[model samples]
Target: MPTGVALREVRAQLFGAADRVLRRDGPSGLTSRAVTAEAGCAKGVLHRHFADFDAFLAEFVLDRVERMDEQAATLRESAGTGTVADNLTDALIAVFGSVAVAIVALVTFRDELRARLRETWPAGVPVLTEAVVMIKDYLDAERGLNRVSGDPEGLAPTLIGSAHLLFADRTGTPPDRAAVHAMVTTVLGGQA
Candidate 1:
């Protein structure tokens, strides 16, 4: 019988292979044979470690989400007393950078993975909704402080959609941090 250490080693190898396949070939390349080839292991090793591709994909996406959420939480905590733009920008950069691979995974499996995501990705909606609320709160607070002028409630969704589309774009160049800030700031001004 395989020892616990041996089992962990095998699972680690499989996850590494899966990660590489996801990165280099997108989500469609995650077949059992593909993973095994990447790992330089017997083809059956993948099935031994995971029930199937769906299970592996679900786990991998969930892992990425959890890691991203943790990073976002850290950024939110450390943003200090910076302007709303500064804090929000730092938090978004952390969240987006970590979840770039997961975003690609979602794009690759757009239709097939939605149900699994609904089940496993509970934080998805809440985090987004909270971000919008935070944007509004920042606007209100900053307006009170005279740092910004406008209704955040009206502008929050536009900013959210801008960031959403920025990452969703498969074009060779996605908007950089400055671009997003400029776009969001413009949206903020338009609400005035």
Candidate 2:
């Protein structure tokens, strides 16, 4: 909007605006105009950076997925350091307490967006699938270190699914940390 000043981190700013739009208005409310308005820029700001709206969306989802990779690495490193349930509890909070839930809903509601994502993400929802991978990999690491038992591959989906249900359908504010911890502890079946 400034006459001469250039915007730094334009992609981040747009992506963040889109995410807020998605969260406040859901998938239907996420549009180029909405995103641009939220970013305090002109509509061309989005098209200028992306081939189309779907392109911007795909990049937005991918950017969040990349964040999950970092979270996965940090989680794997925490293996054997804390109680298994506690670590999982924290990780679940990190995953859902962010924008993963909203992103999942967006992917579910948009057909073209889902199709566009399938080029790289062939199966499962984008943000949710990536979160599942993050949890599963960390669980496998914990299992390797003898910090956890049973099938992590099986447990990971259940944890993600259950947590998804818990985190989804909220009015305002995320589920309490104690509630998430309780769910994790329950899913672990005394493994914690």
Candidate 3:
């Protein structure tokens, strides 16, 4: 039990270090040595916790996505009977904000690492699946009271994909949240 507890602690430390590295300097800043240095441990500590840098990066991305998923789940529960636009806007902001962009970069630019990561760890997919299901559930519930036009299951991915792209590009031009909300309102036919 003590060993398990210690391992969990070490994993948390590794994840936290990864978060700091990614947030401060983006994916380029992530290195096993850098993580160990931030974690105040020897380099071998990461190897013990993760298979390699790819595994570490995958866990880090998934950890952030899980955090975002939890937040969105809570918002979904609390915001009962809210307009789809409002709910989607809140959820998108919660799930796919600037920090999410950094995560996407971490996963996208490092393909070899990402492939290794995917072979061992399926990052971000489950959370996205849950989001889609939740949105579909919400739309199904609201169909009678709301004027939902398109299929929520299909629209959910499209909406999320758009946010993903916008985040990836980092255009720094459009008012992203508002524009996203507008798009959701138009595409999903819900009150914005």
Candidate 4:
């Protein structure tokens, strides 16, 4: 909010504020005014940067998706270095954290935001698709190291699907590290 703050810094601040509002108060609490207030900026800051609230929301979701994709991509670095279940549990935990859960919930409940996202990304925001790809790529890397036996094509979706369920159940207690490890182990046919 300070004068001369870089545009990227302002945008990151706004996005963080929006993410906090979404996580604490759900989609209804995510508005330009609320975001600006939370970010300690003038109310017009969001409007100045984005065409509209929907546009801001779309960009926020896309940013989070890119972050999740990056996290998933790191699995390649850990391949064969630890127990497969442990490595996967760490990745899934990163993917299903509070901020990601909030963004998913926000996009799901807000029709206007969803529609705006579809306008920009006709194939839909590539969060899940990209996650699946990253997971498969990691699994393939592990396979090459002889740490995982099965085809990643079959395994990635099953793991991701279950992770989705675990992530979607916001009303329930979130899964812990042990649970995530168990789920990954099960999906890998007890390879862990």
TM-score of each: 0.65, 0.94, 0.75, 0.87
lDDT per residue (tens digit) for residues 1-192 in model 3: 012233348888888887777777777888888887787777887887687788777777667656755665665564446566877777776666546666667766788666865675565553455556656666655554544656767777777776665555543553467777876776665543
Worst-scoring 10-residue span by lDDT in model 1: 1-10
Q: Give the Cα lDDT of each candidate.
A: 0.59, 0.87, 0.67, 0.80
lDDT of 2 by residue, 92-167 (tens): 9888888888888888888988999999889999888888888889889888988779788888999999999989
Residue pairs that clash (backbone atoms under 3 angstroms), model 1: none
lDDT tens readout by residue for model 4, 1-192: 554334558779998999888877777788888898788877777888899888898998888777765576578888979788888898878877647666767877889888888876676434666667778999999999988999999898788779878777765788888888888988898976
Q: Which ten residues in a row have the lowest lDDT in candidate 4?
A: 1-10
Give the C-alpha miss distance for residue 159 in model 4, angstroms: 1.2
Error of 2 at 129 (Å): 1.2
lDDT of 4: 0.80
Model 4 error, position 77 (Å): 0.8
Q: Write out the backbone clash pairs for model 4.
A: none
Per-residue lDDT over 89-186 for candidate 1, one digit per residue giving the tens place of the 0 to 100 score: 65555544444534554535655555565685654543344455555665666666666666667766566656766665433465688976666656
CA shift of 187, model 2, Å: 1.2
How does candidate 2 score on lDDT? Answer: 0.87
Candidate 2 residue 176 C-alpha distance from true site, Å: 0.9
lDDT value, residue 11 of candidate 3: 81
The lDDT of model 3 is 0.67
Off by over 4 Å in 2: 1-5
